[model samples]
Target: MTGMTAEVMTPKEVETAKEAAIAPKFVTKGVDVYYAEKQALTNVSLDIETNQVTSLIGPSGCGKSTYLRCLNRMNDTIDICRVMGDILLDGADIYSREMDVVHLRARVGMVFQKPNPFPKSIYENVCYGPKIHGIAKNKAELDDIVHTSLQKAGLWNEVKDRMHEPGTGLSGGQQQRLCIARAVAVQPDVILMDEPCSALDPIATAKIEELIDELRVNYTIVIVTHSMQQAARVSQRTGFFHLGELVEVGETEQIFTNPKDERTQGYITGRFG
Candidate 1:
């Protein structure tokens, strides 16, 4: 299990390493992945800093989703996915055999491109994770978790009066927010969103962007977005992946304005995908 171990260092040790040191909530080093002998990600190395948003942008089939799935070992659910890399969270290697995928998922949550709320009441959806994880002992405790999670997801104000309504009965934006609340209920250390706004309207997207900004105060966020503007608005840093390779990575302003790599420049300038 070539999990993210070497990419990590103690905070004390990291402090002396250099100013460029990541202080990462998670790190990936020399990561390679393949599905049935077809490579999906190649020699990918990057750092995901704590309390910040990192956006992965590129053309389709660039392996952004693959890389995101590797963070929580979600790819393990696929039989053909062969992952070779190190993914570290809070200075610990996460791909080791000893690592618990269930628990790992609890710490590292994910939101999909489409809003796929469970077929249950809104309150049930938000409380599901805590129930499975045994995070709450009684109704009061569960209510607090649900309330806080919904508040963090920015849905409390809209849905507090109708917590018993079916989650799937909500509009697309509300459903998406419910999913966000569901993910938050687990109190994840990091959250991965794969094109979370693709199915949303501009207004809904803006709300999510705002929620993401607020989420940065407590949780590290990584989003795979196709909208360059959304990336610019919601992320502090951007990583551009191309054909399964991470072509460039840097501050969002530099990557969007004055990219260092020719490929990056071309992609940003709309010359090529």
Candidate 2:
């Protein structure tokens, strides 16, 4: 008989191996988008890992946001927009006839570039999703959801005393955070941010970046950002889009320091977006 020694793995090594074995949260392949005869994205394919931040970077009108919108079927709202390809969430086709758009959107929440809060109070803003989704059967549950959501978004301290105030009354950053809390209230599995800090000051941008970092521990995050620095800062993986196609994708450090594609290097070096 051949002798074999049993191998023991450290906790960190076991966790790493488990993560490597887990399938990506989202798997997109050969995605193409068209709007009124204009092609917006061409053969875009990428995998969004679970519990990680993936940032899509590209110049304006380069289709990064368009591709992001496809993940949640947001493009379906446009009358002339058409998307083709496989967008799988946990191995299930998101575009299949059986998929519920409302439920999908709830599972994959979104925060826009601007802070677009409702006219309702802060409490109402955060509670709306739970109310609509029937996640809370009573007032106490709804209140708890609001409190926990705000806390997770890092806005609880600022808004605890102002729960009854209009959500629009908050400042730019606060409103954005409130919007994040609103999204978080539903307990989504994924959060998609479209240039989430574009309209904010540097300080506010930093806060949002911090929140993004913290949120990834519980939810997969995909952000479309034009700022290379922001992408480098907040994302564990970075994908670069150019001329409606994904040029390269890799670990953030490699994408920034040693790009595999010249186009990515050019864009990173500030030659041209």
- The CA lDDT of each predicted structure is 0.90, 0.92
Clashes of each: 5, 0
lDDT of 2 by residue, 1-273 (tens): 001114787898778657644779899999999998999999999999988999999888889999999999999999999999999998899999999999999989999999999999999999999999999989998999999899999999998998999999999999999999999998898999999999999999999999999998788899999889999999999999999999999999999999999999999999983
lDDT of 1 by residue, 191-267 (tens): 99999999999999999999999988778899999999999999999999999999999999989888999988887
RMSD of each: 5.4, 6.8
Ten residues in sequence with the least summed lDDT for candidate 1: 1-10
TM-score of each: 0.92, 0.92
* Candidate 2 ranges with C-alpha deviation above 4 Å: 1-21
Poorly placed runs, candidate 1 (over 4 Å): 1-22
Q: State the weakest 10-residue window (summed lDDT) of model 2.
A: 1-10
**TM-score for model 2?**
0.92
